[model samples]
Target: MGRQSILIVEDEVIIAMELRETLEHLGYMVVGSELRGEDAVRSAGKLRPDVVLMDIHLKGEIDGIEASDRIARSYDIPVIYMTAHSDQETLSRAIRTQPYGYIIKPFNERDLYSNIEMALHKHRVKSRMDGSPEMVDSAINMIAGAMVITDPQGHIERLNLEAEQLTGYQLSDVEGAPFFTAFGVSVPGRDLLIEKLLVSSEYGAGSMISFPSTIQIRMKSGGDLLAHLSTALIQEKESLQIQNIACLIEPCAPDTEGRAGGYQGAAALVQAIPDPFACVTEDGGVLLYNDQFSSLCERLGDGISGVALPINRVLPESFIGSLAFFHEILVDNQVVTREKMVKYSTGSIVYTIRYLPVGGDTGGSSRCVALHIRDVTAETLAMHHCERAQGESQNTDAAVEGIGDLCTALKEKVLAMSTAYEQGLAFHDTAHERLAEVNRILGDIDLRLIEIEKNRWV
Candidate 1:
């Protein structure tokens, strides 16, 4: 109807006549219908169609699939596949042809028309969707889903790149086969579903259970396959109608709730993550507390849940006094911060208490006391440990140097004794004095070690 001419390359005479009649009824002009692959290839030179319907199991040396490929490559026309055999190997070959969709054999006029219409519609939709700014839409066309467009009769009218790849039917081989044949085994209660759709609104949709079967297909050439599948409905215009369909099958984090959902512009870049974080309100209240807060209490052996709901119930005694200073910030609606060492039952933990006050017409709203309590205890300990390590390293280096000096002095003393033995002079007091100094240095170092152990809790 829209100047889209179709070329039908079907071997069967009755099937070819039916195809031409269907094409005419659907408002598509048929350029040619050839019974053999060689004749179809020759017809391509005489009559050009917007699309070719190529059957996989066609007559003669050049099969319909191969002939379509040659015509498509040389003349640049799109092709649809028709086939009775939905075997894996034949379908694989059909997909390589990139036909629009397959119409199964023994198909009715409605089924044939639906296939042609759906293929044309999908081609149009692809062009329209690509005009959008989103790259995601284009990516959808490439995903591994069987894209079947069903008419009001539940007949497949259209299919896309993925459907061609999945079913293994050449568009020409099965253009008229019932859609049920494409599905092989029947769906349970499907007849009931069709009845419900007749009673329901046009946009109404539902799912039906399909059979559990794997097909080992044997083409005339003998190819086999076993595929698992289910069926769903999409009655609305261009509606996304399927089970287990991911619109975007790529890496993207979807925020369905919270501040993350509200984050616009730059906020999307700097939101608090899953671990321990704080959100300070304007007036004065701890709006949210997460798993890390509970963990902090567990380490302290205290059941800490309620104190901060309005505020933390089990807050450390040190933090309680800081709260008064924080209250003043709320009164003045000003921000104030205090870092304190919070004591648990076992030991003390350090926290940097940051306060952000909410200012209103009169004063602090009282709803806005955003206490950003960070557990800086680990960081503080790490810094202290690093300092102690460097200090010990320096001390050890000094001690080793002292030991080396002691060794050198002792060797010199032995030489002095040998010289005294030869010259009959005294080498006595110098050796004793050197040994005494070495012992004193060692005793001083041992006392320092004891002092370090005394302050071990830090």
Candidate 2:
């Protein structure tokens, strides 16, 4: 393959020149350089470079994060952020953009090369996987429970953020490491079960194995975690050979049976709701959801077959922003309501989501939050129509009032002219009668106008 091409986007001229020199020295083709975010976006479209080295601060209206988001969504280009600041707020915004890699400023040649190569490799892998690896990654990270994906031999390929938190091992530390060794599992017949599942998957006999009971997990922090473990084999489409094993680990409370019974009762109660309703833990895990919620998930292209999954995984991302205030609901014992406009291929939908604290002390910690979603599309549309109609009616009334004023002025002028004609004409008697008739006609017309205005609604 030819040398990978890169674009440098930095406002500082000195840093931009130094970056170009380093990239060229590392045997990379520097396609273009820009000092502003807007220029960088235009250059990305024109040059179509393999990777972009973006600086967080830029000299234009938009910053690097915004520019990178536009480029990724519009051109599907990979961006690696290079910044001097390491503040949490900056990092959080950058992570939302989903940059391929992030390198702090004053990075070494080796660091630059590695980030570029990794970004290229990941982009290639995503393309090979039908261009949805980013989506899959987002979905995985959105999951409330810890999840790990490993090769058939049990070597780790990738794991989500929750998994990293649970295992206390980052992806960089455990990539290609044996899963069983990295995080110890204390389930009986765990090895035998994995071997059997692998063998069955290889021969196309079975593709999944789920453990219903809770198992003990030896945490990296030297604490024990009780979790429900389930695994499924991801197979190659045509070959039917196992490519990877997906392990879903949901942490459970010690009172598992009692919690299960409570969930069952809650589920029965929520089933009576006509709208989409769900009860989620404070940590965003679904404890119980009604069928309408499940159907809504399916319609939104996120189908949920079990509880304990993350609410983010089951709902659209646009709607998840409101749930971020779940803690506030718990603490204040207040019902938080938000409305979101979701556009579908067929039409737009307006949903009102209400978050209420469920059985928690006032101004104290809460265990669960009830999420109720109502389809308010029709109601919203009707309200808009009503407002529009009222506005038009007001406009019409104003126009009618103006015409009424004009008619009254014209009537008074005609009456004054008739009185003068009746007084000055030689045949004053006949003219007086004619003027009387004209005045009466004008009065009749004014009365009719008043009646029309008064009965406008009718």
Residue 38, candidate 1: C-alpha displacement in angstroms:
2.7
Instruction: List candidate 2 segments past 4 Å from native.
Output: 1-261, 360-364, 416-458
Candidate 1 overall Cα lDDT vs. reference?
Answer: 0.51
In angstroms, how far off is 243's CA in candidate 1? Answer: 16
Per-residue CA lDDT of model 1 for 56-104, tens digit only, reads 7787988877897788678766666677655555544554454555555
lDDT leader: 2
Quote the lDDT for 234 in model 1.
27
Q: For model 2, what is the alpha-carbon lDDT of residue 2?
A: 95
Q: What is the lDDT of candidate 2?
A: 0.71
State the C-alpha lDDT per candidate: 0.51, 0.71
Model 1 spans with C-alpha error above 4 angstroms: 1-3, 124-458
TM-score of candidate 2 versus the correct structure, residues matched by position: 0.36
